[model samples]
Target: MPSKKEIEEVLKLDAEKRFSYTIKRIADFEFVWAIGDQHGFANYGDDNGNVAFAIWPFEAYAALCCKADFANCKPEAIELDFFQEEYLTDFKDRKMRLAIFPLPTDKGILIDIEEFEQRLQKELDEYY
Candidate 1:
């Protein structure tokens, strides 16, 4: 696990760097984090009304985002296999976008499922 300083530095990175870092981390860890309770997972919306399913590479990152609309949610981990086989397929079927590693101050990177898949694949290739 990353220290507080490392996590803070990652959080301060630009959206593209943050997204790439998250992808690399997730590939290395073989899991991903999301904030949610019994109802459903947390989501983010843009001014244009575009909605995205928010995700993170670490529990600390997801836990830090538990505010505002997601105050009641808790950090939950999804194994990489389930994320790739189930969540990604479902999100793509619903035409949902991804908000990777969103912070309270930053909405993070909003990417469609196909692009996210491609990027994640690239990271996994390098990880192996």
Candidate 2:
């Protein structure tokens, strides 16, 4: 398990290695400013091993939530809750989820990353 600082350090290193891009912190976690897409979410860890932040970008609106992860992951995983979209309205002002899993893998081919990303990009491109 890595401490929050360790995770941040890795993220920083990853960012430094990039040729060009900008990532900033919204509340506690870092995120790359996305122009017109909600392709995926950003997961960030803190110096304390007890907490993490999940970032969601919705049609230019960003929401941040803090969550607890008993399973410390260097690359924070993504997941979907067992509820409907209405459930998200309840967390419009929060930072964490009751559960988190590796995203895209939650559903079948239609809802997987490959498909979902395509839809997101097509939608986001319209804004470009």
Query: Best lDDT goes to which candidate?
Result: 1
lDDT of 2 by residue, 13-99 (tens): 432221111112211222222111233334433334322223232212221222233122223222222112333334333433311
Q: Encode model 1's per-residue lDDT on 46-111: one tens digit a residue.
A: 888988999999999999989888889999999999999999999988888999988899989899
Give the residue spans of candidate 1 off by over 4 A: none
Clashes found in each candidate (C-alpha, N, C closer than 3 A): 0, 11
Q: Tell me how far candidate 2 lies from the true structure as C-alpha RMSD in angstroms.
A: 15.3
Name the regions of candidate 2 deviating beyond 4 angstroms.
1-55, 58-64, 70-110
Worst 10 residues of 2 by lDDT: 18-27
Give per-model TM-scores: 0.95, 0.23
All predictions: root-mean-square deviation over Cα? 1.1, 15.3
Model 1 residue 42 CA deviation (Å) reads: 1.3
